[model samples]
Target: MSQPPENFAASIKDFESWPENLVHQTTCLGVLKAHKTRLDVTEPKLFTQEAEDINVSFLELIESGPTFDNLEVSDDEELQQRLGEASRRGEDPKCRFIFIGAGSPQAPLKISRKMLVRVLSYYQVIPGYVDRLLEFDGRGYARKDMYSGFLSQTLLNHTPTMEVDYLGRSGRQLQLCYNLRSIGRTKRNHLAPCHKQWSFRHGAFHHQFDILKGTAVWITTTADLDLKKRIEKSTGKTGMREDRQFQTPEQCLKSSLTVHLLLCDWAYENLRVYFLWLDGTVEDEMYLLVHNRRIHEEYPQIYSLGDLEALRNLQEQTKGALQVLKGNIGVFSGLRDFYHGLGENDGFSLRDSCIGDISSFTRQIDNIIDETKRYLAQGQLIAKIIDARETIIFQHFQSQATEKTEQLTTNMQRHSLTVRIIVFLISIYLPATFASTIFSIDVFKYQDQDPISTSNASDPIKQLVSIPAIALDRWLQVTLPMTCLTFAAAGLWLWREDRKLRREYQTTPICTN
Candidate 1:
């Protein structure tokens, strides 16, 4: 749990008679809730850049950090005590780094560093009222001005070299690890390398640096780099309207530009991964981003951008890269089935469903691309918003598909009783149908008129009139009662069987005492 802010009430406005202070306080509470609820970084330590003068080897960082090295008793104890103290104080630690690993040379050195700052980057977009408090309390100032400025400066200074070799392999691997870790927590720009234009359209910037294995860089950016630092923006110093002037397109562009430099470094690290995944030569030109842009631009024939156009070309030129990846995963899944030798089909249907899911996902990506292009052409704020909505919709669709799949599985497993009931009814109906057919013939009148002949029933007319007529009358009278009795029996049987099945399906032992 996080404590509410002190100046919570001063920030919010327009509460139909609600006190400004109370609204502000509520906003602060919400912000705290959001911050507290964010996903924990699974890797304990957040990798950070070594000091400028100390050029530590990648292996050294990994050995020193929890990622590869065993934790030193001292560090573990110290961290435990610190956490305990913070809990007692009802406060979060300012920041701490703990060393944790030892890995083979092949794995190299990678440091795991965890800090709230990285978490806040995605989590700290406070509500309007909370934002006002952060503004009033100077927390907002620190975040936007000092934080973004420092980050921008660092990134600008170390614009990732276009050359992939400059970024060490250990760093490259860590970049991959971080991405794998972060993608679930945040919106991913996995498509960026394949489609550079995507970044520009969405105002998204991706970083691919590894702090532990290679060099870790902490970078931040503001929507307004210059204006956020202005002396006039202070609570007592300037009016709210005055502050709005600073939040302009130019400011956002400047901030984006600053982050862009850092992104370039990240991209440099990222390119190396694809290069290694592929041979020096890549089949998907989009992957050539691992090569310095200049180099590829110079040698256009050898490399290609893995954008929509490139994807189309690859589809035309050879095997579908997406299909190949899909097929490989499917085959791997089937292999697991083979090993288990489970029930019918060995997840063949599951594989097909998985392929369908992948296809839908790929199509969504294409749709986003198209939507983005349309927005760019229109060049309006509304258009941009529409594009963002489309992105959100794509994400929502994925969520819905997962939910639907779970629901389908639940329904299939739980409906056996219904199926059994249906089967039972059909079986009963088969006998009832035969009885009805026999009762439908004529012959009742002949039997009624001749007593002796009726009793003997040697003649066809007499048999038809007398025997069938009697049988038909009896059947009509008995059929309803028998049907009702059969249905009641079936229902009772099914209920018991359903209970037994349900009990077997459940895992917990029933309590007898």
Candidate 2:
């Protein structure tokens, strides 16, 4: 057997007064005890009990030793000889199985340093084993090296000396630590439990077993209470079942192995269900995107900015979930490989049937992962299509805008030509009209009475459009003051309008491009 450190007692003493913050507080404890019966009976009967104090119970077990009595003589001569030899050699022939489960499933169990030291001391486990157990926390994904079990140096040496002749038999001691993801149902409405909402939780536990002494201790945290109940119930049923046999401690250990297998099966089934849900969701999203694309093609204006934004959000959310699912697949693969290693390891004798079940789970999960990859690719394609279609719609609107601008420019140019022609005509007739009005003011006579005497009388055009003559002084006096006054008034109005425009421009807020 492996020995504890030389200062084991001192170490335990040091932990006795250790602060509470540094250790785990005590919680609920459950015990399963299996006592060996007659040699002829193939399996030992199991009993369940509860412990009020962890330290006291452990102390009792250590002091009292194996609970089964091996002194009674058997009827079979060969078996009796073996028993007698074992007794003479100071060995306990009768096997006793004791399983102590500590802590509830809702939270992780905290073992005080003192309690840890005590348990390790009683089991004669090496000090290095403490470091392994210390790493156990019931959260996070399991790494490749997370879920593992191994045979210690002492167990490897003791296995060859065992009297049993079974193939691939387990050693006297074994240590396994594992983490599993468990699924549970959540009631969106308490009145409607069948509404099909589900959540995921994790369970992590450490198992330490001494086969010869029939003692097993399990330390767990953040485990699923319901799953633990199921395990406990199943273990009880196996002990009570008539067909099953537990003739040796190895057989009992095998039953425990079955529990682990059952757990794996349960976890795998839940994960499969979860993946199917994800597949359906992603498929539905893809269909919706395809439908939207068709609508955009037929009636592009129907889709608004808000609609596109919502679709983009949905796509991102789905992508994130898929990424999480991929990670889960990786973690599940690690779990599968951990169990596969157990099946091959000589220390645990996990049957071929169990390994086969693991393989089946692997193949199914792999298929789901492949399908998930295809969905990811399809999602990316849809995103690109949306971007391309949006660009096309924007370009179409831009072209329409350009066509309207060109039309406006042509109309403005035509209007400007009309205005220029009107200005030219006015410029030519304005001087002549002003001069006619001044001379027609009775300041000069047309000489119509002596038309024949006038020189222009002979020319019909000149006689019809005659230029009247007026006194030079009167004409200058009449036009000069009016012209100067008109010019001065126009200048004053222009100056006032310019100042008004400047003020308005200063008050207006200028928008920058």
Candidate 3:
């Protein structure tokens, strides 16, 4: 057989809209549907037909009586009048309403603020026909385009009103605005920055939402029962007593059934009004399962960041913070008690946090200031030491440079004096050479050459040769020995002078001046 395309609209109409009456009783409200809802139907006959789809068995049980006892209001004449009118219109006053739901049990059930907020977001029912119901004409539910959180408007934009008997006060009506806005803001602030991460550090009930009942509600595990009870007491004193409580792990499981329930009952009342306005028959059409699944999957993740480990770690941090806060309270309490009992002067050491090591509250600030001054004094001392070391090193380098400069100057002066002495010796040798050349030029001319020399002179060539020989002999006699002696004396004198100068240098005092 061929199946028709899932015409979601047609398919949706086949099932009933959600059962609003069951909302208070179960974790879910069964789906329901009706064309002319009790609120929508002006005629009495149409209203009866519309409400027939609601659970017949449940309606029979209510009609049978005991359930009505819980709902009857003796003093609420207005509510009684509305009920009579509904009955006269042939509407089944037994429209299956909230009978049961996950409630606070004595067992341990530990729940995160995230989980509670998610649950609240899931049950956000839209009361579409409340304004038309006449007796409960709330202006917020009258708007045709009013959505729960779509189109940038929160439940706050559409203020909801509810009739309730608070404590001893009966028939009093209040808006869920203040509580809803507070919780919504808390959840929004807590989750707004979590898109960038996997875990968030926050206090317990950090993302709490009010259950239309006026207080914040938290469903917790059985293991934390004792702590939760104490927390409730604390909340009462802290002026947050409006927080309601609930239980998780509905069936019997033994991980420790201690649970904490935070009620946003005061604020959540507005949501209840919006939900109440909904025609019981159209429950299926305005079904919120998709919204429920989205909350279950996404809301927790807004704080958890997809990592189980991170989530646990954040939980642990929050728990630790809670413990620290508890300890602080205990300390403060002990201090108060001690002061009250002044006679017991056992001198309890008060450990102040500002000065970590100090145990006396009286001198805490003084100790901190003293420690700061000590640090500054030590820093200045170190700077002084560093400056002194640098000065010493600079003085040592100055002394070394002065000695090197003086040594180089002495070596240059010695080198210059040696060069001048060598030039002077060369000049003396130049004069001696000129004088020897002149003397050797034959002072007696040709007269000294006797017989053989005169005879050889007559023979022109022989005379020339004889004259040259005489000149050579004279030149050798005068110049050769004299040149040798001059050179020998120069060498001996230079050696002796160098030795004497070196000895004088060795004996002389080193010039400090």
Candidate 4:
């Protein structure tokens, strides 16, 4: 959590520890709350189109866990495939809204859903609003609203969605959302009838109220902005009240929705900061990959498997944040529409301060939304660049690896041929050497029987040496076993190697990529 200013910490913690019932009925900013009180306002306007759409989807939604294919999801993916095989049978999350609020309890009594409705409707916000908020009625409800559920609440019901939009004359409405686990510490605290759900209806409203909180930016619609500008001469002297008070209703919902938007604003800033951190990361990684350098000092991390995983995670987060911003447009648009509606009305009012002052605060939110989008775009661009660089590096290494493998294979084949040539040369020369040694042996030499004597001048004295002829059987005995043994040894080595390769191939898994 971004460290809140010192002024808010103690009070915020105090607000968090209150029981749901007390918190809902609490008064804050000096606004008093009456138990079981209902604001004298009409129920939220319901659109026929929404009714028709829900009528069509009513059957599917009631079937326990509707699938992504069946639900009105963000045109993205199939639930089964995206969730993986283990989660193929996953159940969709049931809506258990924890309508937490701020302020000190006026009454600490538990109320039934009927009574809860009466209390939450104190500000003219729709009763049983979460029913319409959670269901996917062929309209957007699963849309991200920054963990703050109310942003998408009145969306389906145009009347209330556009209802409670008194924003015309300093009209402020807010709804606060909390995790159920956070508010109710004990089973009894949660055991009220409000904890139960109605069949095909909303659960109990766990309204949480807030204390007087000041933000760097206060929210106001353009009407208030324009109204603040037109100065009406007041009996009081020159000071203008840009933050003027308009007595309109039993509640000011600004704090409720303010928390939601605040959470969203903080989340967007976090995302932007993350991207800024990553910008330098990719730059350093790509440099290291392509350049040879001696890093004599500490610096950002080099690329690794973790970096890839982080990149993937960042991409997913960026995409999610983008979807959230898109959905937020509805809430922001509601504010804009309210402002325009105010302009359409010719109201009689005058105030101090630049009309721009009120608007400046509200408009700050709109700018934050815009800034989120730009940062997401920049993150996306950087992600793409990293992907391209990764691809280039992979291909470069792969090509080199392939060349080395081919070269080694060629060298092996050449060595095998050279060995065979040496063996052939030995085979041809061995028999010749054996014959010469046998013939030169003195045991086989016989002295010339006839000594050199007076003989005819035409004939030279000759020495006759008897040569022993070896039998074909003896030669076959000596050579056949040797040749057979050499051939058998070569075949055995090859067979063993082939078997080993076969076993390895069977054991290894085939990679798809």
Candidate number achieving the greatest TM-score relative to the actual structure: 2
Alpha-carbon error at 429 in model 3, in Å? Answer: 2.8
Q: Lowest summed-lDDT stretch of 10 residues in model 1?
A: 176-185
Choose the strongest candidate by lDDT.
2
Return the TM-score for each candidate structure.
0.20, 0.41, 0.19, 0.40
Candidate 2 residue pairs in clash (backbone atoms < 3 Å): 24-110, 107-222, 108-221, 108-222
lDDT of model 2 at position 211: 53
lDDT of each: 0.30, 0.42, 0.30, 0.34
By TM-score, how accurate is candidate 1?
Answer: 0.20
Off by over 4 Å in 3: 1-369, 430-513
Q: Which ten residues in a row have the lowest lDDT in candidate 4?
A: 54-63
- The CA lDDT at 251 in model 1 is 28
Over 1-513, each residue of candidate 1 has an lDDT whose tens digit, in order, gives 343232321221211122222321224555555533332222222222232211111111221232211122222233345334433544321112222222211121122222222222211221221221111111211121210000110111222221122212121111110110000011355643233211110011122232222232221222222211221222113434332221232222222223322332322222223323322222334334323244335553222223335343322211222222232233223322321221133332222323433343334334433433332233333224333433443444455556776998699767875777686876578557856776556642323555676566667776544454665667767677777777787778778987887787586563321
Report the alpha-carbon TM-score of model 2 versus the true structure.
0.41
Q: Quickly count the clashes in candidate 3.
A: 74
Worst 10 residues of 2 by lDDT: 31-40
